[model samples]
Target: MPQPPADAPALAADYFQGYSVVGLLAALGVLFVAVAFGAGRLLRPVAPTPEKLMTYECGVDPVGEGWAHTQVRYYVYAFLYVIFAVDSIFLFPWATVFAAPGYGATTLVEMFVFLGFLTVGLLYAYKKGVLEWT
Candidate 1:
């Protein structure tokens, strides 16, 4: 059998061996970001005005109140897009596992049930006319 590790040197070697490169890389990343930010601060002009403080949109001057009304339909459409995107993320892994020998009928049924929920959601969105471009 091989000899057991020593108290100090072996432990230090084991610990540093795993983390020394990672620590060095982390330190280098911090140093790089710090240098870049410091350089920017040193080189940039220090001009502050009311126009700079105001929010700029498409080069248009400010009009009326800062707050504007937003359509709820747009939010619903975005939320549905997110739901489908998340659904696709899960489906890719499931499709990979599905081809494996051990998982057959059970995986098929589960996937269909998962798809059924998505189908219902899609139908609901269709009924609400959320998919319309006009």
Candidate 2:
């Protein structure tokens, strides 16, 4: 395929022209949201009272302080699991790409680099004792 001119101005102009419809649609989406919000604010009834102002949870009246202490380990464990899960998901597509004729070497190197990053993250988590279960 023939390449376009590498000049910054020319490249930017071409890029904008190529994506003009996308930009226009994005702008329109933003405008639609703004108009919808503006209309909602103008039309909605505001009759604030004590009952309405109070925090409601699943039709049950909130009791005690809203703030509660949560264990940080639970979140760390969940985040670590999510990272591994997503990385495993990435491997399936890479496996297919690795089997393909022209992409094997490139894909293999890329996969190693990706695995190296995941190894570093896992090592960091292990060092922090996040992997240890109580």
Candidate 3:
């Protein structure tokens, strides 16, 4: 049960000073950002034109209204892609772990169980005709 020396208080104070320094740096960063934005607002020219206000896409002049109906199939395809992509990512790590020494039979069974769930989901999507592209 040895007590800390008198210098312990100075060491603790220095530790807290590090946080104070970080806080000061963060405050200065915010101040600089605000000043930059304010200066740009005050010094920049304000000019509004029809072309500048129009929505531009791929360097082509937009011909139709900005608000337009989109096909739901594209969204469904993107969602299915995300789901399978994430599942494949998890499979890689699981495969690596399954190959390790202590994780032989138990890991194999568990992995099959996980794949069964993924298979069920894929089958459900297939049954609903979500996998078809037309």
lDDT of each: 0.90, 0.93, 0.91
Q: Residues 14-128, candidate 1, lDDT per residue (tens digit)?
A: 8898798999999999999999999999999999999998889889988888899988889988898899899999888898889999997878999999999999989988988
lDDT of 3 by residue, 1-134 (tens): 99888799899999999999999999999999999999999999899999899888999999877888988888988998998899899888888998899998988898889889989998998999887888
Candidate whose lDDT is highest: 2
TM-score of 1: 0.68
- Clash totals, every prediction: 0, 0, 0
lDDT of 2 at 88: 92
Candidates ranked, most accurate by lDDT first: 2, 3, 1
lDDT head-to-head 2 vs 3, winner: 2
Rank order (by TM-score, best first)? 2, 1, 3
For model 3, the stretches where C-alpha displacement exceeds 4 angstroms are: 1-44
Looking at model 3, residue 118 earns an lDDT score of 88
Between which residue pairs do clashes occur in model 1? none
Clashing pairs in 2: none
34 in model 2: Cα distance from truth in Å? 0.8
Q: Is candidate 1 or candidate 2 better by TM-score?
A: 2
Q: Each model's RMSD to truth, in Å? A: 4.3, 5.6, 4.4
